[model samples]
Target chain A: MKDHAGARLIKDMIFKCAVCLFAFISLLPLYLILYYITKNGIMVINWDFLFSLPRPIGESGGGVFNAIIGTVMLIILSCIMSIPCGIAAGIYLSENKKGKLSNTIRLCVIVLQGTPSIVIGIIAYLWVVAPLKTFSALSGGIALSIMMLPVIIKTTEETLKLIPYHLKEASLALGVPYHRTILKVILPSGISGILTGILLSVARITGETAPLLFTAFGNQFMNMNILKPIDSLPYRIFYYAMSPYPEWHSFAWGASFILVVLTLALNLFARGISVKWKIQF
Target chain B: MTDRTMLKERFVKWVLITFALSSLLFLFLIFVFILAEGLPLFLKVGLKKIIFGFKWAPTKGYFGIFPMIVSSFLVTFGALVIGAPLGLSCAIYLSEYSGKKTKMFLKPALELLAGIPSVVYGFLGVIYIVPLVRNYLGGSGFSLISTSLILGVMILPTIISISFDAITTVPKTYREASAAMGATKWQTIYKVILPSAKSGILASFILGMGRAIGETMAVIMIAGNALKIPTSILDPLRTLTGNIALELAYATGDHRLGLFSTGIVLMVIIMALNYLANFGIKRKPAK
Candidate 1:
């Protein structure tokens, strides 16, 4: 009996140690990335780095002001294209849970979520960039909005689904029109979740480089026109990092730091909002 | 008056339905466009040659993608080897052993890890992983080993979180019954809990494999984009996605079509995997 008990205790200890070791290993890369980016990236940041346009390849000291502006513009454009469509689609899914059309739509959204972002970029290039006869911010926006669609739709559907059926029933009983009830009561109640989804989708797309590779095609200078090629932070980082110049390498690190910070902040903010406004059934 | 309101409501419902159905329309268009662009390559090169051909030099008219197909599988398999055990153990720990406080802290950290962009991961691979591998292992730092290491980390969140949920959902009564039988904690976990949660665990692994296989940017940055099949984990090799991204910018004519064909191949692989995952999910409740 003593021998069996001792063996069991030893086994338990071994299992515990193994679990702890794996858990620590899982988190190590994230910490290492944060450490490396901050240590290298902080050295390159200055007022000039934030506000100045990128200098020519051989030049040493320029910033990514245009890329920053371009990224924000692309994201805003993508949101404008995606959010209404996504929310409406989500509303349809939540309202009609059991129908042939709803099932097909849900399946499509799931498949889209699983589709590779690069593939979507290629399709977007064919649809938007090829037709436009040039790489444009609009093409990039269209590509990103496609990527954003599935995420937003899924989140909106899940959030709306969680609302008690009785809420809608009550409004209908009080003689409220169906459309008005959904627009005023159901939508307001689910607004926080819908907002959280939008923010998270934005965060997801903000660092996307693959979709924009052929669509936006990276401009060297500041350009505000949506129809024109534009530089984005991710594109800039990819270009600079791949370049042989030491100056460009530093620039890449700085852009990476900024991009990482923005993405992380948006994600956390989304989480914070969701938690704060979690509605009880 | 009521009829007027009814008409307005009907219009709103139709608008929402149209918005909802548009995604399906988009999916159909994507498939049509990809196939329309990609099928020409099969007509020109022949499907068997494209699938079975080992050489992938687009300039030389050798578009055999066997090497790339092999490389993608090897890298994904390597990542699974490294990631699955670690993830499964962590899932077990979180679900079976950790306190609520530990869960609270660790869960958010994992979510943050998931939220971090693939490009950032690629940058980290280029700056840190590549150099480390080059110095210590003695090859181009951008090798299969480095990619596998990064992807192993990348897939951890998917595996751990999903498997954690799976293990948690296994009934408490099973654990108690095992304990009642005088089974030790380790025995209960290995013999009872794992078996019960096998379907969910399997689903997580399938999903992880899908993520690793579809990963493009990070793999391109670290995998050296070599055209040959890797002989070992340390060897450098390119994947289908990497091939597309690397060449698509400069490619035109048949070369462009070839890249789209590669997309068709990747899409089919992902769809098949997803179907398998769905099967696993569907099977779990039945068990």
Candidate 2:
């Protein structure tokens, strides 16, 4: 019995050690990525990189002003197309849980969520770019909006579903109109979750390059037109990193650092807001 | 209630319904547009040749995607091999072994990992993993091995988070009973908790595989995008998603159609995997 106990204890110790080792090994990639990006990217992030346009070949001082603006523009454009309808569709899902329409809508969201970003980009290209005869930020926005819709719709539905049914009933009992009750009472109660979803969707798309590869097509000069092709941070990283020039590679690294910072900040902020501001009722 | 209030409520319901219908309309339109663009390829080239043909020289009038199909499966399988063990270990640690502080730290860390963009992961593969593979292991650093490693790391959060939740949900009574029977913690975990949570863990594995199959930019950066079927782990290869992203920029005529057809194939594969995962989820332990 004593020998058996010793063998069992030794086996348990070995298993625990192996699990701990493997668990830390899984985190190795995250550390390597953060270390490499910060090391290579921090040197090039002065004001000029943030505010000025890329320079012509052989000129050493140009910035990625165009890409930064374009990224923000794309985010805004996608949000405009996605948010209101995402909330309404979510409301429909929550209110009509057992209907065939809701089931179909739920299936659509799942399918869309699983669809590859590049696939979405291609369809967006065929739909908007081919029809318009040009690659444009609008097309990029459309592609991104499609990606955003699933996250927003699911988040909104789950959040609103958790709100006490009595709250909705109480609002109706007080003579609030049906629309007002939904729009004012239930929506407000779930604002933290809704906002967190929107922020997370934004963060997800902010570093997206594949979807924007064809639709945005990318640009070199500073331009604001929705119909024109625009440079985004991810697109710029892809283009520059693929280029042979050492200077271009440095620009890619700097852009990557900014992109990483942008995404991480958005993610952390979304979580913070969701946890801190969620109404307890 | 006033008539105006009643009328306004009805109008608002219509508006919400319209919005809801529009959401479904978007999904419908995506299928329609993809099919409209891609279906002609099959009619023009026949399904067998496009799907089974080994060569994909579009300019020379050939568009076989058999190699890409093979590459997609090979890399995804390799990723699961590398990732699943590490991911499961992490999930076990988080759900069973960790102190409160470690769990808190690790949970947010995984989210940060997921938040890192695919492009950056690709960039990292280019600069970091590729060099290591080339210098130490052999071949051009850009090969099946490098792509699989990058993908393995990329899918860890998905596997860890899902399985962690699954393992955590196993009834506390199961653990107590196993301990009462004189089982060690490891034995109890393997016999009771893991079996109870197997469906969820399987669901996570399936979802991670879906992610690996669909990943494009990272594979493109590391996989060398060769058009041939790789006979070894160090060989470079193209995948369905990579093929579309690589050629769509300049492809026109039948080549463009070919890429769209590739998209259709990709969507079907992903949706099928998702269906499988959902089946697993539906069968999850109620307790």
Candidate 3:
């Protein structure tokens, strides 16, 4: 061990450098992805492209107002359907931690969470589109809400679990009703964490193209009706990027840029809230 | 007021329980409805043929999906080959070599990489990876190798962050003991730290495999989506997920059922992967 000390030291140094070198190389994709998206998409974005409706294939110069509205509506609708149920479900799991029922529910959530997005799209089509006889925003919202449930439920449950039992016990001792204590006291304390989870889940679905492909279908013009088919950033990107026309390809690039921005902002915003607004308790 | 409180508590508890149970319901419904829609194809074509049949032509009444099955698992294996080592090296770099400031900067940079939508990765693959592979390697840009390379990048964040978590859990005393025994730092890491964190790292790779298999739009674009089974990494091929997404829009009759069956197979494989990962994570290193 002592005779070849210098050689051993040199070998370690070389190995360390190799590790660092390869690690740095692994991150090149992130830089390449961000730079390429910006390079290809930046020139395509302008007020006209952002605000106005897209022109038909032959005509030039339009916007993705429909996709923006569609993305917003899908987010809102999914949030409405998922947040309350997910939080409530989360509360149930945390509150009833030891039971066959809770155990089974947790397993199912894991399975659902792991299920592929394309498979979820098929389920949405069969459950909502097939039965309703049309592709609409309602089905898309349902699909996204299904995707959101496991995330929200797991995050909320984990967050709630970390709260000291004394807090709940103190509320019960004060003669506060169980429902009131949970709804008002326990939930408020974990609000930031729950909100963070919600934001991250929204960000996850924002770029989802498969589920909405058959569920929301796509629309060319502005739409607000929840029952009607709608457009979203990802769907728009897919439609235009696949088109043979160069102009449409540019639209796809612009939409891709918009999507990357939206998801990245949401993720950073979630991280910020979790870091800055977390309750010390 | 006391009676009303009791009633309200009971009501709320029941409501929450119902919501909690809904996840199971969703899973059950997906399985049942998908099976219901898909069983017809199996019955019409026979289970053996549906699963093992080589041909996937629909208009001619053939519904074999053997090729897609190979492509799905093969692509995931290829991604694992590309991603697992790179991700592990990066995880070791961040966890062991870097200081707190570097860790803080690099960790979330990885998360941001994960947060980028899959389709954007597909777009990147189509424009960037495809051309490079075509120009350099002498095949169509859209090939199994290109898909694997891009999917490898997509799965990197998953593998790296989880493996980082795993590596950090190795006891500090183990490293100290190794160093005291005249071991080099590299020797200590390879001999002690990695062996201890094996389960966790294995779990991370399993989850990464699931993500790679489940990916659709990204695979659809850069995979070339050919129906044939790939003879080499340079050949274009379609995954099971790709097949469903590509044909479901216009498929009717037994064709639609076959697509649903394809979904069923995809879900089952993913579930099996999740099951293995769950076991891997749950069995922690002995204290």
Candidate 2 off by > 4 Å:
none
Of the true interface contacts, each candidate retains a share of 0.65, 0.76, 0.80
Tens-digit lDDT track of model 3 for B1-287: 57887788889889988999888999899899999998887888898997898999877878888899999988999999999988999999998899999989999999999999988888878777898999999789789999999889899999998889899999899889999999999888888999999999999999999999999989998999998899998999999999988888778777888889888888889899989988988888767
Q: Predicted candidate 1: interface RMSD?
A: 1.0
Best by TM-score: 2
RMSD of 1: 1.4
Model 2's alpha-carbon lDDT is 0.92
- Alpha-carbon deviation at A107 in model 2, angstroms: 1.5
| Candidate 3 CA-lDDT value | 0.90
Instruction: List the candidate 3 regions with Cα displacement exceeding 4 Å.
Output: A1-3
What lDDT score belongs to each candidate, Candidate 1 first? 0.90, 0.92, 0.90
In terms of lDDT, the poorest run of 10 residues in model 2 chain A is A237-246
TM-score of each: 0.98, 0.98, 0.98
DockQ for every model, please.
0.77, 0.81, 0.81
DockQ, computed on Cα atoms, for candidate 3:
0.81
Question: In the order shown, what is each candidate's alpha-carbon RMSD?
Answer: 1.4, 1.1, 1.3
Question: To one decimal, what is the Cα RMSD in angstroms of model 2 from the true structure?
Answer: 1.1
lDDT, residue B21, candidate 1: 89
- lDDT (tens digit, per residue) of candidate 2 on B79-160: 9999999999999999889999999998999989999999999988888789899999999988999999999999999999
